[model samples]
Target: MAKLTLPPLPYGYAALEPWIDEPTMRVHHDKHHQAYLDNLLKAITGTEFENVPPEKLLAGLGQIPEKIRAAVRNHGGGYVNHNLFWETMAPQAGGAPAGELAKAVGKEFGSFDAFKEKFAAAAAGQFGSGWAWLVVTRAGALAVYSLPNQDNPVTGGDTAILGLDVWEHAYYLKYQNRRAEYIGNWWNVVNWTKVGELYGRARK
Candidate 1:
């Protein structure tokens, strides 16, 4: 509500190329994510919501004024979702988690490969525009699920350890209609370091 600004990409648009491509990152980060921030600022400008953090606003969305609830939900969620999406990947990242994260995933999903299979399936099977997540559930274990549109597991008391934007805008330019290919390649860019840190935070 305090004039959310688009987060600058920590890496160049072309850094994640070969898998994500330059044009898609440009539009996704600069144009699309920016639009969500701009619209969210306008939506909360004169309301009681002004000054609330977008993540806090979303975590407590049920308390928002009904008239502007939908705007805040869509745009605010877009803002939070996109920011996390960017943080979840890096230029040369890949392989898998280490330390406690590896232990957690292995304990919960049998093994890291099994976890990848489930997570990738979630990303591939999601219909239409949505996000797939690996989240720390309320029960203190990892879980995988996909949600429609910009919705995330946070509102339901889970912490998103990883998320993928399965919306066409995320990979349409490079993958065309091949979302499975996109999902498979996406693992190569996984910033498991960041994800493991988030997993630690979420566990506490």
Candidate 2:
């Protein structure tokens, strides 16, 4: 596989502050995300799968050799998941989506408020470390769901347009045990414009 480097955050560590803290972004992106990429590189180096593109790896997991599949699944998913996590957030963002994405949300969940309620519920109700997602299912319908560990929707033939990292590492420093508050505040930093782009791409 071509070497996959960590993508830099679009904004400074402090950009999303007051919603997501500076210290957490620093640790989450620099420490946690970097570790996942490092482990993924180790797992794929010198293997047949080494030449596969990073974007194709997760969807092709079944074809990966058994010895390194678990590493690829966990670490690779973590690496890709965090990439989207960072890209889909920005400073001073938040508010309902517009245009096509807005129509889809309304059509699928009744209204944006209802969608937020369902999405937040999925995020807060996730039993342990996991992610909550707004994904395009195989049939090309919008859906909300959560996955365990570092699992990705791609593995199940769904395309995640928006995702929330509910892992303690993502919010514990600022919100402590209040995951609900973290989930609620997370919307304030959500890059809905980017999410709309992803939704369009997924629909295509």
Candidate 3:
């Protein structure tokens, strides 16, 4: 049976330090993310989805066996969300994107700063444990939205090019209820290059 595995961080735990903190990264990846992956694995094991890719399984939730569909949606969504979360950030990678990605953002949101304002608002305004995302709509346009819990945009035929986890566990240890502060600081670690790459692929 094929199984989903956790991918190692591209950089050390401390790579995004001073902004995200080392201890948070350690616990987030080792415990939280691992639990999601494990639960996702358990949810699909021995089922027809056992060999299906994460993206396919998530994008086709309606087809999942009814008994384990919820479990698969929550855990599998977490697994994929965390994977993109980690990949879209890096040690010293925060900066504006260039080229086609930049053009798209500018065209969609008027300006990069405008886009940041909208994205940040979405991330901070997400009511509870959920995620805010910059996704490629089915129509191939950029859009910002927030989804509650582990609901991924893929389920709606959208591609998430960038995402921010607003779940308290993602920042409470360090931000201590200051989600706005955490959200602001998170921009420093965003890997625009990676996001641009995802955007380029999603458009195709």
Candidate 4:
């Protein structure tokens, strides 16, 4: 019901250095993600949806009013997904999953390398603006999924534990036309601790 507000970046804009540049990070967070939050707030104002929290709206999208559904779907999803995406990385994060997440990755995809390969392929293969996700299906299995333009695994009955923004704004400033390179580089900054936490909570 209240206005959707932009969440702060977990680390400084420049923290994702070498992979994602500071200017890009600043624009991506301050401009792109904030636009989504502002638009979502505008889209739902004075409607029945106005009172719903951004996360709750995302989690129960089917209940959103038909009148503003598309706007909310796009903007709200951008807000929610990007928030998760930011938190899913840390300046000092990345490398490999530890604890149960490492074991699960091995079990699900044979090894972390294989998991990286699959996630990268999925992210690269997305035809346009969208996201690549590591999700837990309702059937209680872990899998990779790609959703077009702000659409997310939540819509398909999966719990997203990890995600990568494949939108041009997410990479163009740094990687130019080399999205694959961006995807490859992103693996180096993944916040496995946050991911592990999401996976642990979702699995339970």
Candidate 5:
């Protein structure tokens, strides 16, 4: 099987400006995310995992060969998660959920502000490198979850509808030590259209 390749950014590196700078997006996507794609491919070379799609590899980490499991879990998760992360925002996105997502948010948390508070708290409270997620439970309920380094809600059977990369590298460039500010600004770029689409699919 061929090795996985890094996907191009959906928009220009500078597209996310102000909220996310050009140089940061460039390095994060080109260098860091690409390294994960390369390392994951290298780790799976000549192994059964070589045939697995990068996204599927992340969804089934425990089933990978033990010799390369850790590499796949780390690098593969990074690759998949970052892929989703990049598409989860845009320079023109964010503000508030819309359509069914807005209604769901209203029903789930009473209002959008409440949801934001919970999500921000979850992101800020993560003790170390990890991600914060808005996921749909198997029972069709929405919930907030935080996972440590490369961990995702998929590992626990929850379907991630949207997520935020809370790793220091994700925010250090712009927010410095103020992680809350980073989380707050992140709300300004969320691609609610994509998130609502994912939520619909997950609910089905």
Candidate 6:
């Protein structure tokens, strides 16, 4: 069986300090994310789901074997979410989108600050244990939504440009119960370059 493996962080552990401490990234990536990958790999053994790319599996979760479906949802979602989360951020990154992406944000949300306020509200307001997503809806519009547990928007026919994990585990150690503060500081590392790339792909 083909197994999924944890990918190395693009930057060193200490790369995203202060706003997102080295300790949090270390534990979140090393322990939590790895555990999900390990479990997902084990769950797919001897199943036809083995060797299929995770995005494909997640985008078509209905077709997976029922026996291992739950494991695939939780662990596979974790695996995919963490990968995107890491890529969506950078050490010295942050600020609003530029060029075409900036224009789209203006069209969709009126202005960059308006978009931030709305996105921050979604991130801070998510009930509990979920993610805040900026997705390209099938209608070619940008939309914001939240999902519980490890559920992803791809399964609902949307492409996520960016996502923010609001689960306590993502912010507890550093921000404590201040999910609002975490959401605020998260903008400091919002890799708009990558987000623009994702936006271009979503439009296709």
Worst 10 residues of 4 by lDDT: 1-10
Off by over 4 Å in 2: none
lDDT, model 5, position 171: 80
Candidate 2, run of 10 with poorest lDDT: 47-56
The RMSD of every model to the true structure, in order and in angstroms, is 1.2, 1.0, 0.9, 1.4, 1.4, 1.3
Candidate 1 stretches with Cα past 4 Å from truth are none
lDDT of 3: 0.93
RMSD of 3: 0.9
- Per residue, candidate 6 scores C-alpha lDDT tens digits across 38-154 of 998899867777889887888998998888889888889999999989999998999889988899999999999999999998888889798999999999899887888888888
Clashes of each: 0, 2, 0, 3, 0, 0
- Quick one: best TM-score, which candidate? 3
lDDT of 2 by residue, 114-145 (tens): 99999999999999999999999988899999
Listed in order, each prediction's TM-score against the native is 0.97, 0.97, 0.98, 0.95, 0.94, 0.96
Evaluated against the true structure, the overall lDDT of model 2 is: 0.92
Q: Lowest-scoring 10 consecutive residues by lDDT in candidate 1? A: 1-10
Two-way lDDT contest, 1 vs 6, winner: 1
lDDT of candidate model 6 versus the reference: 0.89
Q: Per-residue lDDT of 71-136 in model 1, one digit per residue for the tens?
A: 888888899999999998999999989999999999999999999999889888898999999999
Q: What is the lDDT of residue 22 in candidate 6?
A: 87
Q: Estimate every model's Cα lDDT from 0 to 1.
A: 0.90, 0.92, 0.93, 0.88, 0.86, 0.89
TM-score of 5: 0.94
Task: Give the clash total for candidate 1.
Answer: 0
Looking at model 4, the pairs that clash are 1-50, 1-51, 1-52
* Superposed Cα deviation of residue 103, candidate 2 (Å): 0.4
lDDT of 4 by residue, 54-122 (tens): 667777888887877888889989988998999999987789989988898999999999999999999
TM-score of 1: 0.97
